[model samples]
Target: MKFDKPAGSNPIDRMRIVGQPRDRVDGPLKTTGQATYAYEHTEIANPAYGAVVGAAIAKGRIRAMDGAAAKAAPGVLAVVTALDVGALEKGDYNTAKLFGGDRVDHYHQAIAVVVAETFEQAQAAAALVKVDYAPEEGRFDLAKALETAKPAKDPNAAPADEVNGVGDFDRAFAAAPVTLDAQYTTPDQSHAMMEPFASIAAWEGDQLTLWTSTQMVDWWRSDLAKTLGVDKDKVRVISPYIGGGFGGKLFLRVDAVLAALAAKAAGRPVKVTLPRPLIANNTTHRPATRQRIRIGCERDGTITAIAHESGSGDQKDGGPEAAVSQTRLLYAGANRLTALRLAVLDLPEGNSMRAPGEAPGMMALEIAMDEMAEKLGMDPIAFRVKNDTQVDPEKPERRFSQRQLVRCLTEGAERFGWSQRNAMPGQVRDGRWLVGMGVAAAFRNHISLKSGARVILGRDGQVTVETDMTDIGTGSYTIIAQTAAEMMGVDLDAVTVRLGDSRFPVSAGSGGQFGAANSTSGVYAACVKLREAVAQRLGFNSAEAAFEGGQVSAGNRTVSLTKAAAAGELVGEDGIEYGDLDETYQLSTFGAHFVEVGVDRYTGVTRVRRMLAMCAAGRILNPKSARSQVIGAMTMGVGGALMEELAVDTRYGFFVNHDLAGYEVPVHADIPHQEVVFLDEADDKSNPMKAKGVGELGLCGVGAAVANAIYNATGVRVRDYPITLEKHLEQLPAVA
Candidate 1:
C-alpha cells in the first residue's frame, strides 16, 4: 500500500491493542536463557574457530606476511592472508576495506584469518602469522588539521563548491543587539554495545548460510555477497536475536566476511568473534567534532540569526560527522546558515552511533540555547516556547505533520518542578552539594523507508507475520505482534512474528529509529490484504467488511475468521511504499529533557538527582517498551555528559582506551529517578500506522540538559564534552 496522502480513519485508529502497554512477548525466553545469540549457535558439528589477525600499523602497505608458521601449527585447518585472497572490492557501505588489502587505512585493520578446531588454537595460531609493514605518517589530529579543512565533497556529484544555508546570517547577526558565539567540542565515542561482532558461516554447494549478530540483515547479506564476488541469491543471513547494536552493527564487518571466507577455505562451518580490544578499533565509531554556533536574538527571546559550522576528520572520500544538519530546521531563525567542513585523518572509520547527527548536534545547539537564554535573562523553557514554529523555518510552505514541541516543553517543565529552580546560580544548597535544574529541547528527523512483509492466515485461526526486521534488544517482536493482532481482530496470542530471516520480505531493518514505524506499517499493509482475502472468501464486500472479535461482519451477516479460511490457508504479501507525503509535510519527532543535578562542594563530582523526558512522537505502539527506550537513552545521556570518551593516540592514530575497563560509562549509582511522558499524537503524513520513531528521539539533546545543569550548580561552564569534573574543579566556588 502506497502511503500517498494522510490516512482517514484507518483500522489502527481503533486502538484495541496498539497503544496498550504490553510486555515483550520474548521477554520470558530471554530472562529464562532460552533465547540464543549469534555466538551461541554451537549445534553445528565440528565447527571450526577463526581468529583474526589485525594490523599493528595505521597507514602503510604490507611489506611481507609469513603464514607458514600458522599453517604448520597444531589443529590449524587453514590460514588466509591478503596475498592469498588477492584484492577484493569493498562494499558500498564500508569506508575502509576489510580484508584482502595491501594498504591499511586505520589501526587494527584485519590482516589475516586463522581457522582451527579450537578457539584457543586459532587464537594462538593467529599470533604466529607475522606481518611486516612500511610505516608512513598520516593525519590524526582534527584540531591541528583544522587549518587545511575544506568544504565537504559529494561522491555522486562533480567537483564543485557547496554550502548548506538559507539566509544572510552575517548581516542579521551584525544588526542584532544580543549576540553570542561559542565553540563546543565532542570527543569520538564507541558504541560499546553489550554484544561483540560475531558470525557463523557455512557453505553447502554454492549456497552460503550465515548466523550473524547484525542490525541490518539484508544489507549485510547483500554486502557480503558483493565483497565475496558471489551472487546475492547465493547468500542467506539469519539473525534471530541481537544483544545490542546502537548503530555499530548496521553494515558488513570483518567478522562476518572473514568467517564466510574461512569456512569456504576450511571446508567446514567456521565461527569468528572479534576480541573486545579489537572490536573498538576494527568497527566504526562516532567521529569527534568541533562546532561553532553563533546565535542572534532579541530582548524578547526571539531568535533572528543562527549559524552553525562544524569541522571533523575522516579518511579520504569519507563523510563528515554532519553536526550542522539539525540547526537548519530546529528553531525559527529567519537568517540561518549551516555548513560542514571535512579534514583528512587516518583514524578508524567513523560512522553512525545512537542518534548520529542529532545526538551530537543537540549537544552543542541546546547548550547554546541555554547560554542565550541566560544572556537574555529569560527562562529556558519560555525562551524555547516563544520561538516555536509550526511550519518549516527554512521553507515556510511546508508544515510539520504533527508538532507538539511546545506541549512537550511546557508539560515537562511542570512535571520536573521548573518553577522551584532559582534563577540565580549557586543559591540552592543541600548539605555538601549544590543543587540545580536545567532543560533542553529534543529533535530528530523522522525517516520512512520501503518496508515489506508477508502475512499468512491459517484455517486454524492463527496468523503469522514474516519480515527481515531485527529486534536488536528493542521490542520489535512484541510491537509487530500487536500490529498484526490489531489488524486481524485477534488476541496477541493468536499472532506469531518471525523476524531476521533474509528469505523473508526485506524490511527497513532496525537503524535510524525507523524500524518500529516502517516495519509495523508494512505488517499493517499485509494485514489489509489478508482482510480483503478473508472477506472475499466469506462472500462479503471487502470495503464494507468490519473485522472485530475474531469475526468478519458486513451489514447483518457475520462469519468467524476461522470459518472464512476453512477452504484453505490464505497468504497475503505487501509492503508500505511512500509517495510525496514526506515532501509535502515536514516529518520529525520532538521532545524535551529536564534534569536536576547535585554537585559535591569539595570533590567537584556531579550526580543526577532526577530526570524527566516528555516525548511527542506520533502514536506510540507500546508505552512500556517506549519508556524502556527513553530511560536507556537517558542513562546513555548521563554517560555522554559526565563520561564516555575514546582517548585517541595521535602518534599511532588509534584509540588508546580500547576496552571497557578504561572506558567509563554511567552505572546505576550515578542515575537516580527517571520518568518518561509521551504526549498523545497521531501523524498521518508519516505512515499508515501514524507512528514516528522514539528510539533516537529519546537521546537527542539529553546531554545538553546535564551539561546545563552542571553549569547551574557550580556557575562554571565547560565547552568540551564528557564534561568531566577535572574541567571545572578549579573554577568551582570555594566552600569549607
Candidate 2:
C-alpha cells in the first residue's frame, strides 16, 4: 500500500486490539530466562568462549605479539592476532580501526581475539598474549579542533559544503533591540545499553551462520561477507532478540567479525564478547558538539533572526551535527542561517545514538528559548506559542501535515498546572530546597522507512506474522501480532509473532523511533494480501468476504480458516511503500516537557523533583509501551541533563570512564516521577498506521527542560551539559 495522503480511519484505528495496552508477548520468556541471548546459547554443546584484547594506545602501531605463554595456557584453543587474520576489511559504516591493523587509529582498538574452551581461559589468555605498541600524539579536543575545521565537501553535490541561507542574518541581529548570543556544549555520550556487543559464529562446510546482537540483520550479513571475503548467501545472520540498541547496534561491530575469524581457526563455533569497559572505549559514541546559537527577537518576543551553527567531528566521510536542521523549521524567523562545520578529532567513531541531532540540539536550543522568553518577560510556553510556525520557515510554500505544537503546549500547560510555577528564581522554597519549573517545546522530524512483513496462516487456525523487525524492548512482537489479528478478524491470542531472523522479510528495523509504525504497516500490508488469498481459496468472492471470528463468509456460505489453511498453509508477503506525501507536507511530532527541579542551597546540587510530558505523536499503536518509551526517554534525558557524559581521556585518546559504574545513567533514585499524556491525534501523511515514532519523541527536548529548570532554581545559566555542581558552586548564594 502506497501511503500518499494523511491516514483516514483504518483497521488499526479501530483500537480493538492494536492500540490496547498489551504486555510484550516475549516478556515472560525473558523474565524467566528462557530467552537465550547470543552468549548464553550453550545449547549448541561445548561452545567455546572468546575474549578480545585491545591495544593500549589511541594512535599507535602494534609492533609485535608473543602468544607463546597464552598457547600453553590450559584450555586455550587458539589465539588470533591481527597478523593471523588476513584480508579483513572494515565495514561500510565503520571508521575507527578494528582488527588487522598494524597502526591503530584510536585508543583501545581491538588488536587480537582469543578463543578458548572456557570464558575464564579466553580472558586469562587475552591478558597473557602481550603485544608491543608505538604511541603517537593525536588531537582530541573538538573545541580546539574547530579552529582548523572546514565545511564538509559533499560528493553528491558540487565540491562545496551543503550550505543554505536566507536574508541577512547579521543585519537582522544587529537591528534587533533584544538579542541573545552564546555557545553551548554537549559532551559525547555512550549508548550504555544493558547488553554488551556479542556474537557466536559457527561454520559447517563453508556455510557460516552467526547468532549475534545487532540492529540491522541484512547490513550485518552483507558486511560480514564483504569483510570475510565470502559470498553473501553463504552466511546467515540471526539476531532473534536484541537487549537494546539505541543506535549502537546499527553497524557491524568487532564481535561478529572476530567470532567468524576465530571459528575458522578453531574449527568450531566461537563466541566472542567485548568486555564492558572495552565496549565503551572501542565502540562508537554520539559525538560531542560545540554549538553557537544566536537569536534576535523583538521586545514582545517575536523572533526576527535565528542561527544555529554546530561543530562536531568524525572521519573525513562523516557529516556534522545536523543539529541546525530542526532550527530552520522550528519557528518563524525571517533571517535564519544554520551552518555545520566538521572538525577532526581522535575520539571514538561518532554516530547516531537515540534522537541523535535533535536530542543534543534541543538540549541547548530549548534552554536558549527559555532564556529568550525570560528576557522578553513572557511565560516560556506562551512565548513558544507566539513564535509557532505552521509552515517551514525556509520553505513557506509547504505546509505542515498537522501542527499541534501550540495546542500541545496550551493543553499540556493546563493539564500540568504550569501556572503554579514561580516566576522568580530561588524564591519558591520546598522545605530545604529551591523549587522551579521549566518548559521546552519538543520537536523531532517524523521519518518513514520502507518495510516488509509476512503473515502465514497455519493449519491449526492460528495466524503467525514474521518479519526481520527487531523488538529491542519496544513492543514490536505484541504490536505486530495485534496488527495481524485485527486484520484477520481473529482473537489476539490466536496470533503469533516471529521476528529478528534474516531469513524473514526485510523491515525498517528499529531506529529513529520509526520501528513501531513502519514495521507494523508492513504487517498490515501483508495481512491485506492474506485476506484476499483466503477468500480466493475458499471460493468466496474476495470483495464480499467478511473475515470475522476466524471464519470467512460470503453469500451465506462460511468456511473455517483452518479448513482453508489445510490447503497447504496460505502465505502472504508485501511491503508498505511510501510516496511523495512527505515532500508535500511538513510532518513532525510535537510535545511539551514540563520539569520541576530542586537545587541544593549550599552544595548547588540539582535534582529532578517531578516531570511531565504531553505528547502529540499521531496514533499511538500501544499506549502502555508508548508510555514506557516516553518515560524511558525522559529518564535518559535526566541523565543527559545531570550525569551522562563520556569522560574523555584526551591524554590517551579514549573514553576513560568506560563502564557502568563510571558512566552514570538514571537509576531509580535519580528519577523522581515522570508522566506522559498522548493527545488524541493521527497524521495521514506519516503512514497508513498514522503513528509517528514516540521512542525518540519523548527524548527530543527533555534535557533542555531539566537544564532550564535548574537555571530557574538557581538563577544561573550553565551552557554545558550535565550541569554539574562544580559548574554552579561559585554562582550560588553564599551561606551565612
Candidate 3:
C-alpha cells in the first residue's frame, strides 16, 4: 500500500485493541526464562565453541602469527586466522573490515578464532595463539585532528546542506540585545547492553544458517552473504529474542562472521560470544562530540539568531556524530546556521546509539538554551515556549505535521510543580541539601521506511503475522499483535506474531526508534488485503464491509468471518510504501523533561529526587510497552548525565575501561522515581497507525535537564557531559 497522503478514518481508529495498554505477548516466555537467545539455542547438536583473539595494537600490520601451540592445545579442533580467510570484501554497512589479512584498523580487531570442544577449551586455546605486530602511529585525539577536519556527507542521513544556513546569522547575532555562547563536550559512550554480541552458525551442504543477536535481520543476512562472497539466497539469519540492543546490535558484528568461519573450518556448528572486555573496542560506540552553540535573543526572550557547530571523529569511511541535527528545527529563528565537521581517528567505529545525534545534540543545545534564558532573566520553560515553531525554521514553506512542544512544556511544568522551583541558585535549601528543578525540550525527527509483513488467517479463525521486525526489548510482538487484532476484528490473544527471521517479510527493523510505527503499518497493510479477500469470499462489497466481533457486516447482513476461510487458510502479504508526504510535511516528535535534584552542600554529591517526561509523539499503540520504553530511556538518560563514559586511553587509542568493572552505569538506587505521560494525539501524515516513536524521544533532552538541575542546585555550571562531581567541586557555592 502506497501512503501518498494523510491517512483517513481507518479500521485502526476503532480503538478496539490498538490504543489499549496491553501486556507484552512475549512476556511469559521472557519472564519464565523460556525465551532462547542466540548462543542459548540448542537445536544444533554437538556444536563447537569459538573464541576470538583480538589484535593488541590499534593500527598496524601483522608481521607474523604463531598458531602451533593453539593447534596442539587440548580439545582444540582448529585455529583460523585472518590469513586463512585471505582478502575479503567488506560489507557496505561496515565501516571497518570485519575479518581480513594483515591490516589492523582499530584495537581489538579480531585476528584469529580458536574452535574447540568447549567454551573453556576455546578460550584457553585462543590465549595460546601468539602474534607479532608492526605498530604505526595513527590519529587518536579528536581535538588534535580537528585542524584537518572536513565536512562529511552521510548517505543515510536526511538530505540537508553540509553547512545549512537561512538568513544572515552573523548580522542578526551582532544586532541582538541579549546573546549567549557556550561550548560543550560529550564523551564517547558504549552501548553496555545486557547481552553481549553472540551467534550460532551451522552449515547444510553449501547453505549457511545463523542464529544471531541482531536488531536488523535482513541487513545482517545480506551483509553476511556479502562478506562471505556467497549467494545471498543461501544464508538465513534468525534472532527471535534479544535481551537489549540500544542500537548496538543493529549491524553485523564479528561474532556472526567468526561463528560462520569457525563452523566451516571445524566441519560442524560453532557458537561464538564476544567476551565482554573486548566489546568496547571491537564494536561500535557513540562518538565524542565538541559542540559550540551561539544563541541571540531579544529582551522578551524570543530567539532571533542561532548557530550550532559540532566536530567529531571516526575511522576513514565513517560519518560525523551529526550533533547539530536538532538545532536546525527545534526553535524558530530567522537567521540560523548548523554544520557538522568530521575528523579521522583510530578509535572504534562510531554509529547510532539510542537517540544518536539528538541525544548528544540536546545534551549541549538545551544547556545553551538554559544559559540564554538566564541571560534574558526569564524562566527556561517560558523561553522555550516563546520560541516554539509550528514549521521548520530552515524551510518555513513546509509546516510540521503535528507539533505540540508548547503543550508538552506547559503540561510538564504544571505536573512537575514548576512554581515550586527556586530560580535563584543556592537559595533553596532542604536541611543539608540544596534543591532545584530543570526543564529541557525534547525533539526527534520522525523517520519512516518501507516495511512488509505477511498475515495468515487460519481456518479456526486465528490470525498470525510474520515479519523480520525485531523486538530488541521494545515490545514489537505485542504492538504488532495489537495492530493485527484491531484490523482483523479479533481479540489480542487470538493473534500470534513471529518475528526476527530472514525468511519473513523484510520490515523497518528496529533502529532510530522507527520500528513500532512502520512495522505495525506494514501489518495493517497486510490485514487490509486479508479483509478484502474475506469480503470477496463472502460475496460482499469490499469497500462497504465492516469487520467487527469476528463477523463481517454489509447492507444490514452479518456473517461469521470463519465462513470465508472454511475450505482453507487465507494468506495476505503486503508492505507500506511512501510517495512524497514526508517531503511535503515535516514529521517529528516532541516532549519535555523535568528533573529535580538535590546536591549535598559539603560534598557535591548529587542525588536525583524525581523525574517526569511529557510526550506528544502521536498515537501510542500499547501504552504499557510504550511506558516501559520511555522509562528505560529515561534511566539511560540518567546514566548519560551522571556517569556513563568510555574512558579513552589516548596514548594507546583504546578505551581504558573495557570491562564492566571499570565502566559505570546507573543502578536501581540511582534513579529514585520516574513518571511518563503521553499526550492524546494521532498524526495523520505520519502513517496509518498515526503513531511516532517515543523510545528515543524520552532520552533526547534528559541529560541536559539533569545538568541544568545540577547547575541550579549549586550555582556552578559544567559544560562537559557526565557532570562528574569533580568538575564542579571547587566552584560550588559555599554553604551558609
Candidate 4:
C-alpha cells in the first residue's frame, strides 16, 4: 500500500487501542526473566564458548600470531585466526575491516578467537595465543589533525554535499548590528549500553542460524552472508530481545561474525559475548567534534545570518559527527550556511550513538543561542520563540508538516517556573549552592522508511502480527499490538506480535528513531488489507464496512469477523511505501528542554535540581512508552552535560576509560527530578500513523541547557563538554 497522500479518516483515528497509556505487552516476560536474549539461548544444543583475542597495538602489522597452544589447551574445541578467515569481503556498513587481515586498524581489533567446551576454558585458552606486532605511528588527535583536514565529499552514509547555504552569509555578518562567534568542543562518547555485543551461531548442513542482539536484523543477515561468502538464504538471524542499543547495535559486529566462524569450525553452536573492555575499542564510538557557530542578529534579537562549521576526525571513509545539521532548520535566518569537515584519524570507527548528529550539534548550537540571548538582554525562551520558522528558512515554499517549537518553549517555560529564574548570575543562592535555570530548543528530523508486515487472522479471532522490527527496549511490541487491535476492532489481548525474526516480513528495523512510526504504519497497512478480506468474505462493501464489537457491519447487514475465517486462517501481507510527501513537506520533531542546577560555591560541583522536556511529535502511540523514552533520553543528556566522556589516550590512540568503573555515568543522586510533556499533534504527511520521532529529540540540546544553567549559577562559561568542575574551577567567582 502506497502512502502517497494524507491519511484521511482511517480506522486508527478511532483511537480505541492506540494513543493509550498501555503497559508493555512483553513487560511481564522481561520481569519474569522468561524473555530470552542472544547469549542466553540454551536451545542451540550443546554450545561451545568463544573468547576473542584483540590486537595489542593501535596501528600495526601482525608479525606472527601462534594459536597452536590455544587449540591444544584443555577443553579447547577449535581456534580461528585472521589466517582462517583468509581474504574476506568487507560489509557495506563496516569502516575498518572486521577480520582476515594482517594489518591492524585500531587498538583491540579482534585478531583471533578461541572456542572451548566451557566459557572458562575458552577464556583461559585465549590468553595462550601469543602475537607479535610491528607498530606504526598513527594520528589520534582531532585538534592537531584539523590543519590537514579537508572537506569530505562523502562522510560515511551522510550526504556528500559539505556546504549548503541560501544567501551570502559573509556580507550579512559583516553588516550585522550584533554578532557572536564562539567555538565549542565535545569529546568522544561511548554508548555504555547495558548488554555487550553478543551472539550465538549454529550450522546445519549448508544453512546457518544466528541468535544475536542487534538493532537491524536484515542488514546484519545480509552483511554476515556477504562476509562469510555464503548464500543470503542460507543464513538466518533472530534477535527477539535486546537489552539496549542506543545506536551501538545498528550494524553487524565482531561477535556475530566470529561466533558463526567458530561454530562452523567446532562442529557445534558457539556463543560469543564481548568483554566490556573489548566493546569500547573493538566496536564504534561517537566521534569528538569541534564546532564554530556565528550568529548575526539585530539588537531586537532577530537572527539575520547563521553559520555553523563543525570538524571531527574518524577512520578513512568514516563520517563526521555532523554537528551542524540542526542549525540549518532550527531557526529563521536569511543568510545561513552549514558545513561539516571530516579528518582521517586512527581512532576506532566513529558512528551513531543516541542522537548522533543533533546530539553533539545542539550541544554547541544551543549554547551559542543562549550566549546570543544574553548579549541581547533577552530571555532565552523568548529569543528562541521569536526566531521560530513555520517554513524552511532555506526554502520558504516548503512548510513544516507539524512544528510546535514555540509551544514547546512557552509551555515548558511556564511549567518549569521560568519567571522564578534570576537573570543575574550568582545572585540566587541556597545555603552554599548557587541556583539557576536554563532553556534550549530541541530538533530532530523525521524520516519514513519502507516497512513491511504480515497479519494472520485465525479462525478463533486471534490476530497475529509478524515483522522484523526490534524493540531495543523501546516498547515496540506494545505499540504494534495496539495498532493491530485498533485496525481490526479487537481487544489488545487478542493480538499477538512476533518480531525480530528474519522469516518475518521486512520492517524498518530499529534505528534513527524511525522504527515506531514506520513499523506501526506497516502494520496498519496489513490490517487494512485484512479488514478488506474479511469484509469481502462477509459480502459487504470494504470501504463502507465498519469494524466494531468484533463484527463487520455495512448498513443493516452485520456478520461476526471470526465466522468469516471459521474455515481456516486468513493471511494478509502488505507494506507502507512512501511517495513524494516527504519531499513536499519539511517533516521534523520539535521540543524544548529546561534545566535547573545548583553549583557548590566552593567546590564548583554541579547537581541537577530539576529537568523538564516538552516534546511535539505526532500522534503518540503509547503515552507511557513515549514518556519512558523521553525521560531516559533526558537522563542521558545529563550524562552528556556533566560526565560521559570516553577519555581518550592520545599517546596510545585508544579509549583510556574502557569500562563502566573508569567511565562515569549519571546515578539517581545526580538527577533529582525529571518531567516530560507531549504536545497533542498529528502530521498527515508523516505516514498513516501520523507520528514522528520523539526519542532522539529529547536528548538534543539538553546538554546545552545544563551548561547554560551552570553558567547562570556560577558566572563561569565552559565551552568544553562533559563540563567537569576542573574546567571552570579557576575561573569561578569566590562566594561572599
- Candidates in order have lDDT scores of 0.90, 0.85, 0.92, 0.91
TM-score of 1: 0.98
Q: Per-residue lDDT of 304-373 in model 2, one digit per residue for the tens?
A: 9998888888754566666776787788999987778899877778887998888988998998898888
Clash count, one per candidate: 0, 4, 0, 0
RMSD of 1: 1.7
Error in Å for residue 539 of model 1: 1.1
TM-score of 3: 0.99
Taking every candidate in turn, the Cα RMSD to the unseen true structure, in Å, is 1.7, 1.9, 1.1, 1.2
**Per-residue lDDT over 273-295 for candidate 3, one digit per residue giving the tens place of the 0 to 100 score:** 99899999999999999999999
Residues 1-736 of candidate 4 have per-residue lDDT tens digits of 9999888878888888899999999999999999999899978789999999998989989888898899899999999998667767888776667888788889999989999999999999999999989999999999999878987542322345768788999999999999999999999999999889999999999899999999999999999999999999999999999999999999899999999999999999999999998999999999999999999999999999999999999998687887887888899999998888888999899999988899999999999999999999998888998999999887899999989999999988889999999898878899988898888999999888999999999999999999999999999999999999999888999999999999999999998889999999999999988988888888889999998778889999988889989988888899999998987898899999999999988888999999999999999999999999999999999999999999888898999999999988998888877899999998888999899888998899899999999989988899999999898877766642
Give the best candidate by lDDT. 3
Off by over 4 Å in 1: 153-161
Per-residue lDDT, model 4, residue 359, is 96
Regions more than 4 Å wrong, model 2? 153-161, 734-736
Worst 10 residues of 1 by lDDT: 153-162
Clashing pairs in 1: none
Candidate 2: residue 691 Cα off by (Å)? 1.2
